[model samples]
Target chain A: MSDDLIGADGRKLTFDANQIRDLLPHRWPMLFVDRAYDVIPGKSGYGIKNVTVSEPYFAGHYPDQSIMPGVLIVEAMAQLTAVVYASAWKEEVADSDEVDTAGRVGYLGAIRQMKFNRLVVPGDQLILKAELGKAFGTLTPVTVQASVGNELVAKGSLTVTERGSGGGNGLQ
Target chain B: MSQSYDELLDQAQARASLNLRVKVLLVDSLGLEIQAELIGDDQPLFGRGLELDSLDTLEIVVMFEEHLSVTISDDDRAAFGSVNKLVDFVVAALGEIPRVEALA
Candidate 1:
């Protein structure tokens, strides 16, 4: 329960890409989340997505004019949720060195009440947040909200299942 | 093997938390600025009138992985065109499975 979580520069986890990869299971073009700040496992986490005209999706989304899509907003939320679960796993298993995410994936069970409050333009920075609504080992209930400052963009809740069972996260 | 729209929609919404979480992850992780809203449970979440576009769909494909923990096949494109369709797909895939989160 930290009000202000700091990063390497004592700034915050807001600008840590290396940490992002370690937590998330995504690659280029597909990966939308850029920085996750104010992260507190199993509680709440805040992240950002920077939309740009240079994105490949913009090429055909509408050559004349590029606009950020709505679905992507959902994806960003899911990723942040994964971090919450993953970080929780790390915290729980920190005592024992027995948990690896290699050769595995997290499955999305469902999304509920997804709404697009505004359009994410080429340069707008989307602020995504996740609050672990319900957590029980591997099966967690996640609630997400995406916004740009004070504006609420989208929100939903879904189930998550981490693959390749082993370690402390496994259900009994 | 086709289910009613109502059945499909219910299945989808009952499927996964990451489905919504990953979309949040990518947008913020990659530094993409975007916005999304809640379409009616009965509303169409795809195509004209909706904020989502073609590329937005592609990102959804990626979102499938980051959130659902499932790899969307090439054939899945059409199924996810509508939010209702995606929910149906999710319901069909992971809804039945007894999920217990485990480390890889």
Candidate 2:
């Protein structure tokens, strides 16, 4: 909600858990989306997740200390990509002949070349960004990078499939 | 269905306490940042208020895996929408392991 949120392109984006909940149906113990910023729907989006010690994984992780896992980093990135496409093309889907399918069907089709540059830990905030990668009919791929400050944490690519009226199987 | 939400919350909170304690032990035992309100129990760990962003999220994810050895599914990783929702989900997820194993 700041003037600066809009990059030079002027397309603005944002989301909260309530919004994410409506978009996706992963309940407690799942649903890894928090808030999104500067999302351009079909083109790109930025997602944010606040890391904390109050996570279940920490109890069994170390008992004494907790560190974030690498796999989750990439998962977070994928979730952000879904948000991007939803924001980008939701309206078009709604207006098209398949509005019903558009309601709950953004799928991450694939992920590639995942590399974690650094370790993630408690109290660290993760910012995931996605941009257009490649497109082929219903499937679109994206380039994603996660970072803290100037340091890169992870980088990879993800592909997503859109849903029209009949395709109601939303991803978790 | 599982033990209970309250039970899970307690479990997550206890671990969270340990993490904070460690943060204090390693970085700020003196509570210096306390004066500036650098971090708080309810402050937003990422974005404008605390300005955490991506790396922080990854750090938490790493911490969970390193300490718990439980992999957060793409479905459940670094989630924070409402403090209540986050704590609830984490506790439930952590507690579900016993049940999952019992089923096996």
Candidate 3:
């Protein structure tokens, strides 16, 4: 119900890596989302993940040739959805002190219609977008897409389960 | 032929087609191990029937929106209990079986 997170022009709420860390439970190599922007709280949002050669997976995924795994790209999209859901949860339970909202956790319950259009490599800044779908109890469906520059790299729908209460808001 | 009889025939044919499309969508989107044609119209979609879990149900909801241009709210969750039920919901929402050729 709160529009405080949304900007005046109907755009602009961006989250830095530090801010993202607070909203998501993922960290270290697993934390794929570096930054996010155009967050529309409880609805949809976009995020960025800068893939680099120094990434640990690059060393093993292919010593001869480096390529970001398709599953990781999907994970990035899921993380962005989590951030959107978490922001909405914060607004919904703003006054509730009993719930420890920090480090909210969720798991990828299902993935459907996933199609990888291109291989992501080092130095590619992946733009991830996730749109909220119908909520059935604690399970939330999200339509997600990932792109490098203007070219789409991946697209799919995912079901994410927020741990704790069965509220449709989000994790925690 | 009576006008009512003609209308009933058209309705029956439309329902038949919608049922086929729904089955295809479920198998394709959920990646069911069985063939789409093999799934019985009245068979349960979850648990022991198709072995689909709650997560699959969410995916199925998205498939309905994306493929069929139909919205299945949480309140309509029970409709997803079976393929026949889902097809009925879609038909009711759309007022007709959407032209599958157009969707392709």
Which of the predicted structures, 2 or 3, would earn the higher lDDT when compared with the native?
A: 3
Local distance difference test values of all predictions, in order: 0.61, 0.59, 0.81
**DockQ (Cα-based) for each candidate:** 0.02, 0.01, 0.43
Q: For model 2, what is the alpha-carbon lDDT of residue A148?
A: 73
lDDT of 3 by residue, A1-172 (tens): 1234456775446778998887887889899999888887778998999999999999988989999989999999999998888877776876874444444557887786599999999999999999987687678888899999899999988888777654343432
Question: What residue runs in model 3 are displaced by over 4 Å at the alpha carbon?
Answer: A1-6, A10-12, A95-99, A102-104, A117-119, A166-172, B1-3, B33-37, B95-104
Please give, for residues B3-104, the per-residue lDDT of candidate 3 as tens digits. 698888876777777788788888877777788778899998877888887777777777788888888887888897899999889878988776563122
Ranked by TM-score, top first: 3, 1, 2
Winner by lDDT: 3
Per-residue accuracy of model 1 over B1-104 as CA lDDT, tens digit each: 99999988765554443234433443443334553223333344454434454334444555565666655565666565554466557657776622322211
The lDDT of model 2 is 0.59
* Docking outcome class, model 3: acceptable
Q: i-RMS, every candidate?
A: 13.4, 11.4, 4.4
Best by DockQ: 3
Which 10 consecutive positions of candidate 2 chain A have the poorest summed lDDT?
A: A97-106
Give a tens-digit lDDT track for model 2, residues A3-55.
Answer: 36455767776777776665554555555667878777678878887778886
